[model samples]
Target: MSIWICRACGAHSESRSGPPPKCSICDDERQFVPEGGQEWIARETLASTHSNDWTELEPNLISIGVSPAIGIGQRALLVLSSHGNVLWDCVPVLDRKTRDRILELGGIKAICLSHPHFYTGMVEWSEALGGVPILLPQADLVYVTRTSEHIRPWLGDRYEVLPGITLHRLGGHFEGSCVLEWEAGAEQNGALLVGDTIQVVPAKGWVSFMYSFPNLIPLPAREVRRIASRVADIRFDRIYGAWKEKVISSKARESVARSAERYIRRLES
Candidate 1:
């Protein structure tokens, strides 16, 4: 069956023919089914049903719409070079308009997700774009539902999918959590797109670590140090986060280093 959105929690799934507004995870979350009642959108329905407004935030980055009032809270960094063009993270919906827009920019070289939740419609995205591969760190493979021959796996700290783009596994939030490092990264005005593996504190334009569990768990100070070290080796002066408010300018790399080190020092002190 084609994919559909759960009316209750907005989860996208191909599990049609089940009970109305069916979603076990949302049920467990204690989020009730929608009062408007159950509704479904087929995979093909996106062509007409969903319209993505892609706004270019930088040279090779765009924030695709995640909601009328919010973007995916994840930014997609497009890598363009003699090697190829790639989208660093995946988002939930992809209609023909978006697909065509992305294709016009040299098509997608590959699709990579920083972690499980960000997997979004990656497989569907790949399929719609003529089977562009989905590169996921093997450590987070269990979270992927849409597996394809086009889905590639990276088993270690870093993988180079394209010439200028690299994915670095920082391992704080999720064991396989990552950030994209463009060869010409933020400094080139291209931006380093971090999808909350290290998050921005909008109040101060700094980065911090998070433990994998969402129940307010905190990442250990040493783990934060390690993440900082991993990211430090890469060169990116600018940084852009998923949504509009979570971004910082060309000095983000320096800020991230200082913030991470400050966090580590505080814990040791």
Candidate 2:
């Protein structure tokens, strides 16, 4: 038995025998499978060939990602909170160096994901990191290929993982798609760690929402408005997207509102 990782989207599957025939994550419309067909790599091989690079985005926030870019190539965040550290999103590689470095940074108390696409190697991550609880949204439970006892699924619109860090489900990319609100980030102005649920586009000071990012499918006007309305009351001065250097440094809340309005106007036009 081995854990097979999808080469395309980086989602993990635990097989009692061998690699699964297909990766459901890559097959979905939100993601896509390569023309060469599905490819799977064992966890051990992944660890041996690839490594993680860590960067301190701010005082208590760290960005972790795999080198050589496996899967969707999104970076995970380590949020150091007052109560405990929370890993906001996850990647495919978790080796000795990655584990040791994280341990030196006070360790992680919990793991919260933005959605299913970033759910790569989570079960192994939990087991290796002191069996910490994986706070997963109940709405996207069906996307979980690897099951573990450490997963604590939650329902509703929000969940507070620490003193000032919370997870808010805004539901754009996926039904359970969400973002992390860290009150202590951005020098106490608050920060939102949004995966592609609310994309930090190449345009500075703006962000966008999508139903299928890779497929170029746009979310309807009503859904975009609802996502904007859901985050209207949150106090955040910065927004962090999945990839590196993808941030709205100031006036992020205002940026989101303005961006949404612009997106809707373009759609209506």
Candidate 3:
């Protein structure tokens, strides 16, 4: 028996003799099953084919993405703080080279995710790096496809993972969708690593919040306002989205506020 991971979204499933009947994540409205239908691959199979590539986004933050693009093809960010290194999101494949490279920099202290779609290989990652704590929002517990002892369900709207790193739940893309705020990032002005919750659009300095990004589904105005209000006061100068180069260089706080208003006005009109 081995843990099976969905090829589409990269969410893991329980260990079994064969692949599960279907991937609930792919079937859900927020995501979609491939036209060819549901497909599954073991962790070992993924490791053999894919490898992680690291890029330094800022002084102490590095973006880790798997080569050939696995799953949603989102790149995970590693924030290096005085407290320790914090992995903000996850990729499907975690191979020996990637593990060694991270260790060479500084071993991960804890792993935090933005939502369920990025929960791929969290258990395996924790185990690979000596069982670090995996802090997942309690609100999204039902979305956890793979169960593990390393997971620490966090309650409430805010959770401080390290000295200067914090997770804030904004509840747009998912009920438990959260963003990581690094106080010392962006040359000390602060940086927000938002995974799909507040997507940094192709247009610079603009962002969009949605319930289903792939499905072109917009979230409710009330939900968008709630998400905006929750992050309205956060002092962040930069915003990083799930994909590579999807970032807002400055005035990210105002950008989010403005984006929310724009999203609401368009929907209400």
| Candidate 2 structure quality by residue, lDDT tens digits, 1-269 | 68999999989999898899999998888889899999999988988899999899999888999998999999999998668899989998888888988888778999999999999988888988889899999999999988999999999999988889999999988999999999989999999999888999887898999999889999999999999999997888999999997899989999999999999999999
TM-score for all models, in order of appearance: 0.83, 0.98, 0.97
Q: How well is each residue in 199-248 modelled by candidate 3, as lDDT tens digits?
A: 98887789998899889999999999999998986878899899987989
lDDT of 2: 0.92
Number of backbone clashes in candidate 3: 0
Candidate 1, residues 1-269, lDDT tens digits: the string is: 66765433334566547434454423432233456655545555544555567777656566776543211335455566567788777666777787898788778888876666566677777888888988888887765544568888888898887777888888887788888877665546446778788788766668777774344567898899888888878777777665567787767888899999888887788
Which candidate comes out best when scored by TM-score?
2
Instruction: Report the candidate with higher lDDT, 2 versus 3.
Output: 2
The lDDT per prediction is 0.69, 0.92, 0.90
* Comparison by TM-score, 1 against 3, better one: 3
Query: Worst 10-residue stretch by lDDT in candidate 1?
Result: 24-33
Pick by lDDT: which candidate is best? 2
Worst 10 residues of 2 by lDDT: 79-88
- Candidate 2 deviant stretches above 4 angstroms: none
Which pairs of residues have clashing backbones in candidate 2? Answer: none
Candidate 1: pairs in clash: 73-242, 74-242, 75-242
